[model samples]
Target: MTTHPAETVHDALREEPCEDAWWMPGPDGFAACALSSSARTVAEARRFTRATLEGWRLCSSVAEDAALVVSELVSNALRYGAGGGGKEPAAVCPAWLALTRQDGTVLCAVSDAGTTAPVVKVPDHLAESGRGLHIVDQLSDAWGWTPPDRSGKTVWATVSSVRV
Candidate 1:
């Protein structure tokens, strides 16, 4: 894929999955996966996320942050995405995650078929819900989402290896 220098942030995030199909063109490395929207698939995605970060020799801090991002993204996909006949409506939605190391940052992107953008809610102290995107925003250098060309959208984040 030809990466345009002036591409929008949405384009950049969408392109990462396709660009990272095998590996990225960088010194670090890349990992990509097309996951089924199922409970078992979520577990698999977690493993894949860990392996991908470790394979790239990312710092522990980056890896940990990436893991959390992966978990939240995958969980959101399984919950809101179309797959798994587990109490949810049946729709064919493919979920994916891609990781790439660029310059001094590690970029992670997760794509799913839900067009509704994710929101970071202010959860009450006693409530045991929400806070996924909130944590991602606080931990990563940057985080955002993109609507794909056809359907679905991708949520992405970047974190620096070194503490800022």
Candidate 2:
């Protein structure tokens, strides 16, 4: 279920973990879910994202970009997020993925238990590393990360949902 922005302002002030329904409406024009920490999670997230976008009637417009965004975000979370602890570098950390619509804008957010903000680095054209956020910046209308609270931070991007 969705609440008007003004009506939810007070609730928004209280720091809360990113729940499946965060900033979304009920049964229409919104969806969210948690992603398990696993190497395969990125691929699974991409598939889930495409299906969800299709169910929301947005696949024809933003499915490709959304899939790429989901993949990169989840991969980053698993690679550098808290669960790895810089020891078990291959471990995947629990993360959350959410989608919401507001005034013709579709927001895609990935939450992980990492306090570090994502960095956008300029990668050499031939380089294979450090280009995820750059790709996100190129594809989404806008992108940024929320400061971590008790649960962690959420990196989000917004894309226009209006099909041209």
Please tell me which predicted candidate would have the highest TM-score against the true structure: 2
lDDT of 2 by residue, 29-58 (tens): 666655666455676667666766666666
Error of 1 at 86 (Å): 14
Residue pairs in candidate 1 whose N, alpha carbon or C atoms collide under 3 angstroms: none
Model 1, 1-164: lDDT tens per residue?
A: 22434543223334233321222222247666656645556555555666666666777778777788777877776566534333232243357778788755878888776756777788777877687777788888888989543466788988878756
Cα lDDT computed for each candidate against the true fold? 0.64, 0.67
Instruction: Candidate 2: list runs displaced more than 4 Å.
Output: 1-26, 84-93, 162-164
Which ranges of candidate 1 are over 4 A from the true structure?
1-28, 83-93, 148-150
Estimated TM-score per prediction?
Answer: 0.71, 0.72
The Cα RMSD in angstroms, rounded to one decimal, for candidate 2 relative to the true structure is 9.7
Per-prediction CA RMSD (Å): 9.6, 9.7
What would the TM-score be for candidate 1 when compared with the true structure?
A: 0.71
Poorest lDDT segment (10 consecutive residues) of candidate 1: 18-27
